[model samples]
Target chain A: MIVFVSCIILFLIGLYAIVTKRNLIKIAIGFAFIEYAVNLLFALIGFKRGALAPIITQIDKPHNFVDPIPQALVLTAIVIALGTTALMLTVILRIYNRYKTFDIAEIRKLKG
Target chain B: MLFIPLLFALPLITAFVIPILGKIYKPLVWIVTTVVSFILFIIALYGVAVTQEIPMSVYKMGNWPPPLGIVMAFDSFSAFMVLMISIIVFTTSLFSLRYLSRFTGQWKFYTLFMLMTAGMMGISITGDLFNMFVFLEIAAISSYALVAFGIEGEELEASFKYMVMGEIGGLTFLLAIALIYAKTSTLNLADISNSMQVIRGTTFFWMIIGMMLFAFSIKAGLVPFHTWAPDAYPAAPAPISSL
Candidate 1:
């Protein structure tokens, strides 16, 4: 599907940012983008054409519903993404305070 | 049997309790950490003995069946890993008691260490694919914070680099899990393994395998993914690097 392909493309874009960008903040943003893309892909996986929200109200009535598992998984994934993103930003902030730069080239004190 | 959940629960509960205890009395955190990890090591030993007696044991969360709920599958391999993890964690906590005296926020180190232990233990015992991912993230995130515990420029930079690479691998893993779930319609490891047989050798199967391989190889620091490990290991403290 086009949506799935777009998700992969978004992920690739994030990867590209991480690999090529020199700014620490940009790289963090790239990681956020990647997390969002993956979470979107997971949520999209459970989407149904005409299915209703997965809610059961009556015992006798049967209703079409979208898969709820992926939705739940996405919620967990989002929380994890938030944790990683916050940590990444915090580290970046510390790096800026110590080195006084955002450029990766200038930040390199450890080398081969 | 009940020791299976205790493997993770004990450390997790201790991790949170450490910080609060640190507020009351700083040295109490160290004592609690040591006691908890020692208990965990014993539990892991029991797990190994029990698994040697029984081939496999399953603990259904909330009394739900395998296909419908998350389960903890304890087998020989899991027991082995759990034992290995506990041994390392116990020794590391002991080592840190003296090693971390120079550090101001030693309580944070023990907290993150216990959390990482819980995460690794959860990963080893979890029977659901998503549960594994959650535990993986928990461990990975704590390790990232641990790597940056010093707050030095180089440590922060290394942690940043490691986080980027690690998150990429983790997201790739999530994508693979999504694909697997889309195909199998189940998240339980046993259920998915049962359904996967029918789709074995298919292109989709291979794709998922390749993605998972890529992700795990990064986690394991395989040849191509070895860059982050060298930097991360050297930047972290001695015990954490060893861990």
Candidate 2:
């Protein structure tokens, strides 16, 4: 339960960073943090106390094993996070190149 | 039956093929995208007709049965969405053929467009929650890149802002999926629906529903989350904005 609460806290912290931080890179880092926190929570969800890895060697043996679905999901989520992170960083680089600064306050071309 | 998978597969295959075909001939990219989208539109029409006869059709990927493997559920609603997507994609591709002549990297635009089409189609037909998320990400990522395709100052800034908010919504969705899995121990939509009956009106169920609602509202650009739509729509090209 503490771990789950910590995960929510981490997610909130990342949300705070994204909402309050002015730097483009810091915002990207916050997105990464949120991704990691979600991935961690997913992986932790399938964990079982004293359960072995989900590997079936015998047909009739009744063995305690952790749920493997969340593990597979985490792997896919990690790959997606990688793609989003790379794309975000590339966009940030382009933004910095055009604006000559990392501060979001300085880049205000699209305003209300 | 087969038309359901081809709705997405044809575009996905052509998306990768266009980049290579572009290396050989530039105009081939436009030709191929137009042809593929037209064919997809035809297939969607066929799908709608078929679903009209058979209201619900299920295609189990790799012959895996329900609750075990990913399934594509093609109902009348999915057919309607697929038809709508095909119409929009075909029209947009036709419009962009001339509209994108001024752009230097035309092939990249078509590739991303096809990917987005496939993603949206997959989302419509998929019966698994995780598969929907994957397709959603595929479409969302492609849109992010497409929004920034011009590489201009305003476009890049708008794409960045849109991406941050979108990712936050996506993460919240993943958190909800995790909780749902922990409670139901299943990711298949039908299975989850069956199991969710017992837990209906519970706090946990409401939490999951609320999280999903929040995520989808961001995707749909509801009132509170409409800020990204205004910026992103204006930043993208006319054809993409239409899509």
Candidate 3:
């Protein structure tokens, strides 16, 4: 329960960064932070108290294995996060190129 | 059985194969994408037929049962979603043929477009929670790239904003999946739904629902989460905006 609470705290911190930060890069980093926090939360969920890694070298017997589904899902999520982060960075680069500034306050062309 | 997965597989194969063919004949790209979408539409119609007769169809990969292996289940809802997607994809592919001439690397645009289509279809049909996440990400990453397709300043900024919101939603979804798995020890939707009957009134359950609601609200562009939608919709090309 404490672990899950702490994970939500990490998520809130990232949300704070996104809401408060002025720099586009910092906001992008905030997004990355959220991804990491959630991924960490997921990895922790599948942990068994004293279980071994969920790998079976021999089929004779397997017992007390940690759940592997969350691990696999987290891996896929990480790869997808990588793609989004790379694309976000590239977009930030272009924003810097045209606006000549990283501050979100100054990029006022699309204000609603 | 074969057509259940083929709805997504056909377009996925075409997405990769068309790029190679595009280098050989520039005009072949649009033709192939349009035709693939049309074929998928036909397949979706057939799926509608199958679903009408049986009500639900489940296809297990590698012949593994529902709890142990990845499953793709088609019901009326999934068939409906697929049908809608194929119709949009077919028309957009045809429309983009004329609209995309102003942009360079038209082939790349079509490639990403087809990938997004496949991803959306996969998401709608998948019965496993993790598979849905993977497909959601595939669709999302492509949309981010497509929004910034022009490489212009406004477009890039919008795409960045959209990407941040989207990533947050995706991560939250992952967290919810984790919580659910911890509780139920299963990732299959049908299994989870069946197991969910016994578990009730837990904080984790509420958290799962809350997180999923937040995540999908962002994805669906609900009122509060509408911040990124306006900017992104206008910035992307017409076909992708509609998609």
Which candidate ranks first by DockQ, i.e. highest?
Answer: 2
**Cα deviation of B215, candidate 3, in Å:** 0.8
Q: Report the C-alpha lDDT of model 3 over B1-243, residue by residue, as the tens digit.
A: 899999888888988998899889999888889889999989999999998899999999889988999999999999999999999998999899778999989999999998999899999999999899999988999999999999887888788878878888888888788888888989999999988888766776777899999999999999989899999999999999999
- Label model 1 with its docking quality class: high
Where does the lowest 10-residue lDDT sum fall in candidate 3 chain B? B198-207
lDDT per residue (tens digit) for residues B171-216 in model 2: 8888899999999999999999999999999998999999999999
- State candidate 2's DockQ: 0.82
Clashing pairs for predicted structure model 1, backbone only: none
Superpose all Cα atoms of candidate 2 onto the true structure and report the RMSD in Å to 1 decimal. 0.9
The alpha-carbon deviation from the true structure for residue A27 of candidate 2, after best TM-score superposition, in angstroms, is: 0.7
Candidate 3 reference-contact recovery: 0.74
Each candidate: RMSD: 0.9, 0.9, 1.5
Model 1 C-alpha lDDT per residue in residues B1-243, reported as the tens digit of each score = 788899999999999888899999998898888889899889988888898789899998888988998999999999999999999988888888778888898889999998999999999999999999999999999999999988888899889888888988999999999999989999999999999999999999999999999999999889998789888998898889877
Q: Where does candidate 3 stray beyond 4 Å?
A: none
Name the better of 1 and 2 by lDDT.
2
Candidate numbers, best TM-score first, in rank order: 2, 1, 3
